[model samples]
Structures are given as structure tokens and as C-alpha cells.
Target: MATQSPFPFLDDLADRVGEALQPPPWFVHEAQRRIVLLVNHVLMQEPEAQSRLARHKGSVVEAHWRHFQVRVVATPAGLLDLADPAITPDLTLTMVEPSPLALARSALQGEKPQVRIAGDVQFAAEINWLVDHVRWDLEEDLARLMGDAPAHFLAQGARGMADALRRFAGAAPGRPPAPPSGTAR
Candidate 1:
């Protein structure tokens, strides 16, 4: 029932800053390139995901959020690469939540943000499958660098922190909900 954000001024300032501080075109382009590379690396670890993507080889998927857009095309190798700017995307997904804080709050509470989908339905289905089924094994990746025990310890700490954040965001993990801001006994 509370209609106010915990940090109202910061939230408003962030929204304004986000609107006014759009990154340069080259910076956005380079960020998109790195994102594609990371995505390909994750996809490479899952053969089933790769096979599903490979079935749609050359299909383009473009995602838009605010002023940022990333267009990637499925490659024959079952990986993704940045698509040419001119190639019309076979599928386009636009995130409906405009506020960064709102989106993060939804994510921390284990909810998916709303998306507006357009273009190929089958391609969208494949992408949805990828989202639901594929997960990066963070502990495994960390263990490769720092050995098993430390990696597991770090992962557990992270999970505990995430759970704390989820609780702070109004999730009930067998605990009472946090009191509303500006309220005290």
C-alpha cells in the first residue's frame, strides 16, 4: 500500500541521469560487441542450446531497452555475433519496464520483466527456451580459477547476500515483511 520509494530523490535523480547521460554511439556499439561475445561463450557450454540456436542459423534477434539496442544473428557454429546494422531483425524484443530500479527490483524478487515481442514466433519460442533452461555455472567457473573450496564458499556467500536482498525487496523467506519506510512503532 506504500506509494513511495525508499529513496525518492535518488530514484528520481537516477531516472533523470539515465535519460540525460546516454553513452556515445561507439561506446554503445562496443558494449554490444562484448555482450554478444559473453553470450556466445555461455551458449557454447550448452550443447542443447547450441543445437536449438543452430536450427535457426542466420536468424536475427534484436533487443531494445531505452536508447540501447543489441542485434545479434545466429551463426552456423551455433553461436551469436553482432548483426549488421542494416539487416532487418527476424525477431525483436523490447523491454516494457523503462526504469532501471524497477527492473532490478523485479529481478531481485525473482520476477521476469515484461517484454513486447515482435516478428517470428518460433524464433521467440527458441529464445524463451534458452532463457528458461540455460544457466551459467558460476561456481564451476570460479573453481577453475580459485579451487573448489574457496569458490563454493564465495558462491554460498553470494547466495546468502542475494537472499538478503530478496528479503529486503519484500520477499518472505519465512520471515515477516519489512516495515514501510517512514514507519516506526
Candidate 2:
């Protein structure tokens, strides 16, 4: 017969704690992955236009397009032939002036949406860059938000940008601009 030490449980507990001390892989990527769905959900609901006063409305009904700029390159090669448009975001967050005390009270009450408190101040440029660069499966992207995906694929906005660019370039004042410098070949 063998006798075990009374300290055996302590050793098991220490080993379990050591394993738990190692960070979970999900913790590393959760925020990164969540951002895609979060941004998509927010932008999809953004309003086309808003009055200056609309910014002040705190109701869930409030929505506004955080403006995004994509550069236009005038060339004769047709709009589809254009390269990536330079993305510059110009979003100015204009929220309603709040009662400082009221805001403080709400803060204490934890009623404010986490998005606002999280400093998710809509960065239009980053979104545009992501939309342009990532060859997104739009269906998948949407589905991911709807909790339908096994994984997420980034969405591509370049197609839409190219469409818009083509319209702009066609109307630009120039002699078709010789198909841009590098693109001539």
C-alpha cells in the first residue's frame, strides 16, 4: 500500500492556477473581431444627412452619416480602371450639449451606451480604408453581425468607390488625362 502526502491537493490547485494564469486566445482577438461587426452595425444605420440640431438628440432614433472622403483621379481609362482612391475621413462628432450633472448622474447609473463611452468616435477614414482594402464578403460580414458566421471576412468598398470615381472623372475638366502615369502600360 502507498501513502499520499496531504499537500497533494495544494500541488493540483497550483497547477490549475498556473494554467488559468495563461491568457485565453479569445481575449486577444475578441476586440479585433468584434470591431468589424460593431462598425458595420453602426454605419449601416447612419443617416444620410442631418440638421445641426440633430446632433443634440439623444434618442436611439438619432443617426447620422459620419462623412468619409475618397480621392478622385481623373483618367481616360474608364472609372473601373482606376486604382485605389485615397481615403480621408472628415467626421466631426457633434452631440447635444448635456447637463454636466445629468451626464454625471447617468454615468453613475451606467445607462449610457458602451459605444459612446468606449471612445468609438466614428473614424470614417479607418472605416473607408478597411472597406477599400479588405476584400470583404459583404454577405458574410452582414451575417457575422447577425451571428451567422463561423468566421468573418472583411468587406470591400472599393467597388462602390470606383463607381463613384468614374462618374466624377468623366465630368472632370481635362483631356482624359492620359490614363495616369504608372497605369499607362
Candidate 3:
């Protein structure tokens, strides 16, 4: 059975609103810089991901969604840097989805957006490996700012909330699984 939304106009409204709100050049550049920093940070924690990226050294990968685009080059140190806009990218990943509402719903359902991949096959494979293997450890990152116990506490709460949300948006709730081997439930 197909469930319909009461407010179907919201999707169209969101698309129109997004089209109306054009960000300044500075905002786009700043957002891209932040994205590079975050990506590099996650890559640094995974030596294998970095080493794989290092093999591609100067290879540039450009990602596109609608009018926004970002180009990043693999660095010798296994990190990523904003690539020169004039340089042609070795690989390009263009997301096929256009609606923000659909993308958000897909994300909530733990699904990947469809993407059109182009260019260097080896570089693309390396990127695919990184995507499958690398993940940011938010709890560990939080531990750096606060104490371990407090970080764990907050992370646990957040995880539970996320799990509940996932259940609501996705699969039906089943019996709660036992906690990992160690620590009380």
C-alpha cells in the first residue's frame, strides 16, 4: 500500500525556496573548505584509507549536486585539499537526486543516493573503498573535548535516539538486542 503525504505541495515549495535562496560565493567556498577539513580528519584516523588515497596523490575528484560543486585533490600525505578550479578533475561523482526532501527521506531510511560516476576507474575504486571503510567516530571525537565517561554517556543517549528514529522511519521495532560484551545495559 502506498501512503501519501497530506502536504504534497511541500516538496514543490521546498524546491522553489531552494532555488530562490542563492548563497554568496564566500559561503560556498567556506563550506567546501570545511568539508575538506572534515574528510581529511576522518581519513587521518584510517591509515589504510590514507595510504590508498596516497597512491592517487594528485588525482582530483569533483562532486556535483545541482549548481553546487566541489573539487578536491588527493595529497601526498594521504589527506585531501581543495583542488585548483582551473584543473580538470580525474574523477567526477554526480548525484542523480535533485529534491532535498527526497534526499532527506533517503538518508533517514539509511539509503545512499544514486550517483553517476565518471572518469578514472582506479581512482573511483579507491574512493569506493574509502567510503565503505572510513567512518567518523563521533563519540571518540567528543571524548577529546570532554571526559571519556561524559562522552560515552552523551553518545549512548544520542545512539538510542537515532535508533528510535530509524525504527520510526524504517523497520518495525523488534526485541531490543543485548548490549555489547562489556558494560552494563
Candidate 4:
């Protein structure tokens, strides 16, 4: 027999709470601004990435996931700015998987969710290259804020935690078995 959840009404309660606590329009705008700032911070680290983006300056890329959507255009400085609503997007990328939990799981596993791409093929290629190549050097950023040694230690600890979580997630219900040790079965 299958075990039932201890709180059967929790899902309904969560839905109600989520609807009631919808973020204000200003909050959404601020959040998007912060996201753009963070993306630019990462982009600034790699000159080549900036150069590639500069080629696509003014081209709008719209990304949609669930109810959230953001459109960004490359600036002359090779950084991203919010796209004008009146402008048509050059490319659109839609997240195929809608569930936040599934997306988080894929991220923790160092995988990307399937995305449906539409519009300019060359622009899409550039975006794909950016996704594959651009990565935030969190440890380096932390070192700038704190000392190098402390930042290294924190980064090491974070990696260990991530590994442990990955192992745990892999061993979850309905997951496939871990690979066998080198010996013949």
C-alpha cells in the first residue's frame, strides 16, 4: 500500500498562499533589473564573450519559463539591457519543462532543461555559445570581497555540498541505479 502525505491539504494551501502573495509589479521589475546586473557582471569577466555579444548588439532575445518572461537586448558595451516592449524579439527561447522542482534538479545535476528555440538561427547559435561558454567565477568574486584563502575554503565546501546533494538526488525514489564498481557483475 502507498503511504499518503501527512498533510494532504498542503498542496492546496500552497497554491492559495502563492496566489495571495503574488509579487508586486515594482518587485518584479526590481528582480529583473538585478538579474540583468548579475548577468552583465558575469559577462564582463570574459572579453571574448563580450565581443561575441557586441556583434549581436540591439538584437532582442526573449526567454520564457512558466509565467515569467524576460526580453533583453545586447548593448553597445556588450552588456544586456531590458528590451523595449515595442520591439520584436529576434529570438525566443521557451523552457520546455515547466516545473520548478524539475528545473532545480536538472541544475543540481549540472544539466540544462530542454528549451524550444524559435526565430533567427544565427542569433540562436550565438546565444547557445554564450550559454555553453559563459560561467560566473563565484570563487574569484568571493575572493575579491573576502580573502583568497577564505574564498577558496568556502568554494571547496560548496562543491562538496553540491556533490553530496547530487549523490542523494541520484539515489532518490524511481532513480536509476548508480554505476557498478569496476569489477564484473
| Best-matching candidate per lDDT | 1
lDDT of 2: 0.35
Q: Which residue runs does candidate 4 get wrong by more than 4 Å?
A: 1-20, 172-185
Candidate 2 vs candidate 3: the TM-score winner is 3
| Predicted candidate 4 versus true structure: per-residue lDDT over 152-174, tens digit per residue | 99999998788767766556577
Deviation from native of the Cα of residue 74 in model 2, angstroms? 39
What's the CA RMSD for each of the models? 5.2, 26.0, 5.0, 5.1
Considering summed lDDT, which 10 consecutive residues are worst modelled in model 4? 1-10
Candidate 1 has which clashing residue pairs, if any? none
For model 4, name the residue pairs that clash.
none
Candidate 3 lDDT over residue span 136-174, tens digit each: 999999999998999999999998777666655564336
How accurate locally, in lDDT, is each candidate? 0.86, 0.35, 0.85, 0.83
Report the candidate with higher lDDT, 2 versus 3. 3
- Give me the displacement of residue 39 in model 3, in angstroms: 1.0
| Count: clashes, candidate 2 | 4
Per-residue alpha-carbon lDDT of candidate 1 for residues 31-130, written as tens digits (9 for 90 to 100): 9889888888789889999999999999999999876788999999889999998999999999987667767887888887788999999999999999
Residues forming the 10-long window of minimal summed lDDT in candidate 2: 74-83
* Candidate with maximal TM-score: 1
